[model samples]
Target: MSDFLVVGGGVIGMMTTLQLADAGHSVTLLERGRCGREASWAGGGIVSPLYPWRYTAPISRLSGWSEGYYPELALRLYEETGVDPEYRQKGLLYLRVEDEARAMAWAREVGKPLERVSADFLYAKEPEVAPGCQEALWMPTLGSIRNPRLTRALHARLSAMQGVTLREECEVRGFRQAGGRVTAVETSQGPVAADQVLVCGGAWAAALLEEVGITLPVRPVKGQMILFKAPPGLVNRVVLMDGRYVIPRADGRVLAGSTLEDAGFDKTVSGEARESLWASATRIVPALADCLVEHHWAGLRPGSPDGVPFIGAVPGLENLHVNAGHYRNGLVLAPAATRLMVDELLGRAPILDPAPYALEGRLAGGL
Candidate 1:
């Protein structure tokens, strides 16, 4: 029996397991399918939440902590696993500012650098942007990471660790509890004993916890993305307008996305969504109208009631914990969330105020 069993293989689950193992805990991670191919892989890899000011205070704090930690973590992953997640500070450009005053106020409140650029400056920085996009707010410290590569690196690093076991295609059917503690997890293969269990099942997390009588309030939020194969340096930075974004990858692929729908675990790519995303992309950067559509796909983000993920011990269950319901900011919030979970599980002083993300507090009508 391992000391810990992490259910779900998304970036959060993988990173949590890796940290536990690094701290000398015997950790085993179970994934229903291949790890990291879910929302973690489908995301645009932006390290910060788009328009961070729009989110709640908890999200802002977690994102701020992660923003500073990602570069060091990315470098360490490359050094250990020889896989660069391509973490880069390409900056994020908000092409249209509907509430400029509010955005400026939030930026100043958070101490984030926000600069207003004129049409000439915007054109000089990105010539492909449509002429209609005359002004923008540039956040120069924004960054992105190739999420798939980062997940792979974490998988590899965990596999190389001594006490970490990764079981792909091993679905946890249910849990076996004794008294108030979870004793073991029943999987398709067999039962695996665990001293503690963490449910990081992403979109499927709610159903899993429901079986144990825990109402996680997590639902699947479907987001569709369209990929365009363009020349390198076509879109130099991440461009955002009306909550839709065009992210430039290191491999010369421009990713334009996405549409958030409460489609109940349905990850279908619709023609209408494609048209809308393509139109949005072309509207922001007119030159992208000529780029070939490389791929169209959808992923299920774990949506919570208030956009804050539940990241503490489960009430009424002593040994069971949760770190799911990240909604759209899983990639951006992974590092800080992982740290918080580690601190909570190890009984150490939390780096940030844990009350904002506590599961018990959320259950008791706390934000």
Candidate 2:
């Protein structure tokens, strides 16, 4: 039997599986669709948590711990799998920020580099931004990764690793519990009995937990994004304005995202979202209006209250755990979330405090 059975093959699940394997545990990773096809693949792969100052302290801590490890992790993945995750530390320029004092205080507290850019400096850096931008907050240490490439690299690496079983297209139907533990996972194919289990099912995690009478508040929040085929260096890095931002790829592709909608369990892109995102993109960089809107799509983020993720053990279930509810920050938060999960499972002191992320006090009714 596999030592651990992990439900969900998105970034969180995949990263958890890898970390467990690194700790010398045999893991069987099950995915509903092809691994990494969900929000993990659909995301723009911004290394920073979206609007970092706006998130809670737990999120900030997790992201802060994860940020320093990306460059090395990306390089390691590339070295092992020959797939470059395209981790680039370009920077992010903030426009129309509502709370400069709050942003400054947060930046100072975290020791993050924040620079106030003059209009001349900001426009010179990204000349296409909308006019009348007086000043901007610049964080040069911020970075990005190509999501598809990172997932691909992880998939390849996981497949190559010993004590790891990668099962794509295997849908976990439910969990079979006995004596305060999940004995096996009932899957579309058959019953997969592992010594332990983890539900990292992203948006679909809540339903899976409900099967065992555990009501976690991890629900699906829909976000839509539009991709543009633009010239390289057109946007000059990442630009944020009024909850919408454009990410420039090393190649000539610029990604504009996204809308926080209450649309549940829906991954369908919309004409309305396209127009809105296109408007946002062009407003930031007018040149994008001329570029081809190559692709438009949507992904379901695992949304939790206050943007805090639920990570760690299910209260009564001894062998089953979870690492979901990251909302829109999964890509940036996965490294630390999964790392700390491994530490918890292995009974080691994690780099960051795992208390705030545990399902104990964070959840409302479920215990």
Candidate 3:
């Protein structure tokens, strides 16, 4: 048995386990299903939040800190694991933006570059985008990644690392507590003893905590996404209109995501979502209509109130910690959140302030 046990083998779980093992700690990751196939894989890997200015300060801080780290992280992961995460910085263009002023103001506040481009410039920059897009916000620095690939890279890295165990299809039953500390985890396979345990269970985190008398508001919010098979260079960059987005991949296929539905743990893809997303995506880039939709899927996002994840020690439990409830930004926030939790767990200085992600108020404001 490892000294550290991390529940939930999503991106958050795998990344944290990798970091702890890299720091010479024995860590084991438990996943109910496959690693990274849940919310982590479900999200469209947009590095920046959907709307930059709208999110709270905690999100901004973690996102800002992680944004700069992705390029380096992506490169290093590629170098070491040989799995290209396809991290691109072609920029995200927001068409028919509702609040350019708020976006620009927030950009200025955060020292991020946000530009307003004319229709002519928009058409010229991304020829695929439909013309006459009134006004658009061109966020140059932000871009996207191949989420499936990133999880593969993390999984590959952890597999190579010593003292790290990646257990898939391992559903955690509960925890064994000695006094207030978690001594072992009761998993589907069997009880795995550990000095400390961290729950990174994504949408299923709350139920796991409930067994140990720790009720946290981490419910499931189903997000549906679609894939369009187009040429590689058809869509140049990430395009957003309203709440829908189109993320172009290195290959010919492009990813058009995501519907925010509060469907509890139901990952069932719907025809309603398909028609709605198809209509929304085609509006932004009319050219996508010419291509065939390759696939459609859904993921259960761990919806916490205000969309801020709870990332610290669980109340009344000394060795138990949580790093779930990332809502929609699990992939975007994984690196920094993992680092923060690793630092705190290892008694090192934190990467960012930990107050905003505390468990105090979030538990009361249940989902």
Candidate 4:
């Protein structure tokens, strides 16, 4: 038995493992399938949400903290694992043909460096940008990472660690809870005992918690994305549209996404959703007209009503913790979320306030 048994192997879970292992804890990660192959690998890679200034102050703070940590985290992973997380700081260029005043106000409030651009400015900067795509908010601090690479690097690092054990293709069937705390986890293969347990099963967190009679307000929000093989610097920065976004990668690929649907555990790609994403992306960058579709996939985001993640102890269950319900910002908030989770597990004071991510409120009958 290890010190901690972490269920789920996405960015959040892996990052949590990194923190725990770095703190000299014996950590075991269990994945139902391949590590980081789920939502973490299939995200748009936007490190921050569109219009983050409109969010609550706490949420904004968490995202900003995560954004700042990405560079250091990437560097550490690269140095140790010999795999670059490909974290790039190519800021987001959010365009808004509508609500220019609101955009300006938000930029000023958040202290984000933004410049108003007209159609001529767009044409001058990115000639491929659509003709009607005028007026944009450029945030220099925004950036993205190669999600798949980051996940792979984390997996490799964990595998190479002496005390860290990863059990892949191990679907957790239930939990062994006694005295109001989870003693161990029962998986399809066998039971693994540990002093502490953390459930970080992204979109499946709620269902996994139910096996232990704990209820968290986490639901699967399906997102469909499309990737295009455009030139590397075709769209240098992330571009945002009405509610959609386009992320350019360093490897001559651009990701366009996504449609938010409350589809339960459905990872199937939809033709209609693909068409919608294509239209939305083309509306922003028309040059994608000739781009070849390289990849199309879907992922289930663990969404909560308040748009904040559940990243603290499991209520009424000592030694049981949670680090899920990040929704779309799972990749963005992975670093901060994992650190706070490990702190809770180790009984250390958290650097960031954990109230917003408290898991007690959602417990049945308020625990």
Q: RMSD in angstroms, candidate 3? A: 1.0
Report RMSD (Å) for each prediction in the order shown: 1.4, 1.4, 1.0, 2.1
Model 2, position 85, has a per-residue lDDT of 96
Per-residue CA lDDT of candidate 2, range 256-358, in tens?
9999888888788889889999999999989898999999999998988777788899999899899999988999999999999888888899989889889
Give the runs in model 3 whose Cα sits over 4 Å from its true position: none
Q: What is candidate 3's lDDT per residue for 197-300, written digit by digit as tens?
A: 89999899999999989888878999999999998888888999988889999887888888989877778999999999999889888999999999999989
Candidate 4 ranges with C-alpha deviation above 4 Å: 118-121, 364-367
| Candidate 2 RMSD to the real structure | 1.4
Tens digits of per-residue lDDT, candidate 1, 162-274, equal: 99999999988998988998898999979988888999999999889987898788889999999999999889999898888899988889999899898897888999999
What are the clashing pairs of model 2? none
Candidate 1, residue 157: the lDDT equals: 91
Q: What TM-score number comes out for model 4?
A: 0.95
Better of 1 and 4 by TM-score: 1
After best superposition, candidate 1 residue 181: deviation in angstroms? 0.6
Worst 10 residues of 3 by lDDT: 358-367
lDDT of each: 0.90, 0.90, 0.88, 0.84
Where is model 4 poorest over a 10-residue stretch in terms of lDDT? Answer: 358-367
